[model samples]
Target chain A: MTALATGTGGVGSCFISQLTWLSKNLPSTRLSLCYISMIDKALYRPDYAEIDFDTALFTLEATGVEPPPISTIVEYLAAAPHNVILVDNTSAISLAEAYPAFLRRGISIITPNKKAFSGSYQLWQEIFSSATSGGSYFYHESSVGAGLPIISTLKDLVQTGDEITRIEGVFSGTMSHLFNKFAPTSGSGGKWSNIVREAKELGFTEPDPRDDLNGLDVARKLTILGRLAGLPIESPASFPVESLIPAALENVANADEFLRSLSKYDNEMEEKKLAAERSGKVVRFVGSVDMLGKKAKVGLEWVDQTNPIANLKGSDNIISFYTKRYGDMPLSIRGAGAGGPVTAMGVTGDLLKVLCQLR
Target chain B: MTALATGTGGVGSCFISQLTWLSKNLPSTRLSLCYISMIDKALYRPDYAEIDFDTALFTLEATGVEPPPISTIVEYLAAAPHNVILVDNTSAISLAEAYPAFLRRGISIITPNKKAFSGSYQLWQEIFSSATSGGSYFYHESSVGAGLPIISTLKDLVQTGDEITRIEGVFSGTMSHLFNKFAPTSGSGGKWSNIVREAKELGFTEPDPRDDLNGLDVARKLTILGRLAGLPIESPASFPVESLIPAALENVANADEFLRSLSKYDNEMEEKKLAAERSGKVVRFVGSVDMLGKKAKVGLEWVDQTNPIANLKGSDNIISFYTKRYGDMPLSIRGAGAGGPVTAMGVTGDLLKVLCQLR
Candidate 1:
């Protein structure tokens, strides 16, 4: 069965490449063509179109092209003969209203998109119910911890009588990177700025690292996780986001400029690191949803050096679900949380899960 | 969906208890009755018969029942109102002949029985083909590694374009126990009699630990692994059996008497352990199936402390499947390889997998 996948930027290109690889490896599944670069095509350059295939290319007639609309895309999907799967990897800002239409038509949706799950609670419930009723599935396994199988594992645990009471973890790849680079004893001076710049060069951070350094990405992930675990989670904006970027660097022109301006905040951060080291603690950006307070927040927490999260290296994400079945010792899952191949694999894993369900 | 599980001795009772628990937890899937204790009907036992409402009960007429002459059980199964999923948790002596008849009847078999897979190669092929043609399945996930999902993982990898080249691991829990106790620094006196006695006392060894210490159990597991990985394997008896018990001890009347006479072999084992330790290695009873050689074997091998198998603690079993996709980094799976709950859970897991496929 052929699938149509959208978006081809950053993680989006990785998703496209993974689908291409899956198509070749799993002959039973294929990706025919993609709908991408319809809006501000110059802003997004994809490497997928270089391959020899009949791609339904679209671009803005002017500077702002809407690319028909979601309903039009749904209509195109309805007319297609072989395509049975719809993968939306876009950040079109209109997908929040478009997903339900695809679900109603029994077309499975496998996405890393956080919008649908973290949107209005009623709409999320409607989409969930509609997908289930239509004999199709809606999987956002990659929305939580990338490639960790967190959502699937949680579903299995709940189905098998595990009661999850508290959820705590370092959910941000950007924050994880920042802490790993800046919290070490040798993390002083201009080296911090160079490390942040290197992270951007490697595509570890967003086009604007502010989206990550400000904790919004982590907040969005935690919101989706909360909803998947059966909580009525609110918007990501409601969570208190402590920005690592100082006020002076907030208005920087681009990522390079922002990195250059971040040098001023290094001393403040280094002082905190020194104090933490003296007390045998490591600074980690932690997001938690606790049942005791029935709340969720993302903040800098001083974890003891002996704790699992404190010693986590690079962009690895670790989660501990404290449940009744598991008792005092929580069920812990740890893995590399951010990378092209890993995140792409997470999306691919979700695709496989959908295929298994549909088959 | 109730099943009438027969043979309730050793691991059989554990299966019966698991079925009962699954029935209670999943009320939609109830186990009607189980055949138990034909040898001593008057002995005090757990009440597995409590759930027998509209379900019929059949009693085995003989002690040490050897699968009821095939035709008799087939006839009994065919006449039963409910569809039966036969679970054979018996010894090799019984299962070697019983599996073919059930396969022809389209009855699903979820077994921990090692015999059928470790039997003649032709018989294994026939049973598998018959099950396929009859529109049923013969799942023996628990056969090789108890609760570790080794077969399921291998099947998944194979289905996803992974070519498995080499398979190795500690395949016997009883042997693991023996090695751990007799490894010189274990402080269990490093005596063969003490180790064997302690293994039995700790419930790691079977009622007759001869099959384990003689390496036959590990050989059987390796044969099964070889078959599952698509290798044409010979019978378990084809592998050389290295007996730790001397000829004089082997002639002992019973297991207790054999344990009482094992002191003679202590010095020999201690010397070997010391030599291994000095060479920066730990002794493990390793089972390996080499694709290049097209053979399977179980033997004592010295592995460095850094190896995954060397770090295995207690009754932990570890498997490394070297495949084309996974390359030099073998897919390692580790967990409890023995125990009533873990083995029962493995059977339960296989049942759930069947249910998932059916759905």
Candidate 2:
């Protein structure tokens, strides 16, 4: 089963296109879209009929009914003829809370949604434990670093008995873009406030720039990775996350008002950038987990000019896994961390993995 | 079943240690060693029995008899009660040639051995086809880039219906070490002859350094990757590979004599380094596959001062995958790429993957 929105350029819509390609290319896979939904409407059959992957979006939009409650959907999936995989494309916390319900019903899950994994630690424990009891699988590779192989690589390293001492990287595409432009390695980049304004105009930032600046996105990623590395992180708020929003403007009534006053802090950011430059370094917003120290942090750091973090280009996310096997130098993976097609690729890849193991 | 030779400083020995660790940590995986062997000696029971992973090496040396022929071993593995996974630790072409025989009988294979995959195209085709016919699995992630996720990542990208346009990297760790010391990014590095001699003394090169200088290692890696990327590469020899070994020393009978005469080409290498320096670049030996153009090559290239390839440190390997989805920037994985622990880690990682799919 899969869910996608009808709007143009939506990740849900883009994911459906990739699923269509996958269904056509992998003929051996018995792919069937038995359920699909949006927030308000859904398209599914009482008889558990396979929805046409090619016209799923159009079909849902044309003739959809009110989405059933979580319990009803779980019951419907639990009674399917074959194994079922739930593709959660939306970032709905309510849907995320229903993950254990689906997994307990012997339904697997493949998703890019972070809330299911990065939410409260209690939910995290419940999800994995439920999957174990129900003999179901759950994969969320895109939750932390979008389409990059961060999650899988870490799992491999840990599984192979390699000790991961640390994991640090640029986890947020928005922060990566803002910092790369505001204090670039090659040149003195644009003013901080102007860069924020430009990034918002470019659609790189969240609808409200403060949403990205508050550092919750990066902290949430760190929280998920820390837990995966064997640390029972209570939540994203359990660690120290340096928010970029000034204390003075924490309660700005609107984004326009926030932007109007953001320039006032340009001198403060310029000072940090110049200080890093004076030390022959560049500034980058980064998140790191010291596994041995049992600590995770997200904030600005003065990275060396030649460091990979400083050399990031075009808002790419770079993660370095410092492990026992890959000694001295960490095993690093770098690329576009967010987007419709690539992120969808991660979900699709996980779905294939779950398919291979299903009876 | 598992097998490892008994010796100090042997990859087989290290692999057993890792396998022992894995068995202890991952209790769900029912790993057992039914056979153990060295080049001349082997140990096995008439009835397949689990050999203790911790003591397999010692037991093999203490009680092993003459190793049976390849066909006999295939029959032994095929007759096992449960599924069998053959981990080929040695880079023996004879063992590689028997892959089809084993796969044709439903025995999975996991290895860092490059010979089986990079050999004659016919053998590659036979191996894969035989695996398909017998319903067995084969994974050789360590064939290139050790345990740096090169093979798995490429497989993910291709499997997800992404278009791979190009693949380029410094593949051979020995070559990476020699070239980095010969033409460092930040300094006028040591003379090429001295660097090669130093690398040999440091145990970074093959017994006969010429084996590494012949450029065949990188070519073999490129062949495997190119074939995976959907090119019908005939063999490693089907493309241009510039050997770094000078013509005068090509026929040297021993490594000692070759080392004594290698100084004659120092000026030649120095000139090449100077040429690159004139353009404000550094020289590094690299392998590249133009997936779109259907070509593969291995040789030296002038890399930019700030390029990741130029900045590579130690004997690390770096691979960059340029694809349609990941536009402008390529997805790159970098790490140690060589060494017994990391390479064994790859084999172990592949074993876990096979374990997941086994009945």
> Which stretches of candidate 2 lie above 4 Å from their native place?
A1-9, B1-9
True contacts kept of each: 0.00, 0.81
Score candidate 2 by lDDT. 0.87
Worst 10 residues of 2 chain B by lDDT: B1-10
**Cα lDDT of model 2 by residue, B299-340, tens digit:** 999999888999898998999999999998999999898988
Of the candidates shown, which would achieve the greatest DockQ relative to the real structure?
A: 2
Candidate 2 CAPRI category: high
Model 2 TM-score, all chains together: 0.97
Worst 10 residues of 1 chain B by lDDT: B36-45
Docking class of 1: incorrect
Write model 1 residue lDDT over A166-202, tens digit each, in one string: 8888887777776777674233423566777788888
lDDT of 1 by residue, B1-359 (tens): 54454444556656655565566676755455533333333111134343342222133332224334456666666555655566666664564567777777776677787888888988898888888776666788778777555776566545444467999998887776677656623343366668788888887787877757788888888888887788877688876656666777777889887877677777777787778888978777888988767877778789865565665556667777776644455545555676655565566666665555445
Highest TM-score scorer:
2
Chain B TM-score in each of the candidates: 0.84, 0.97
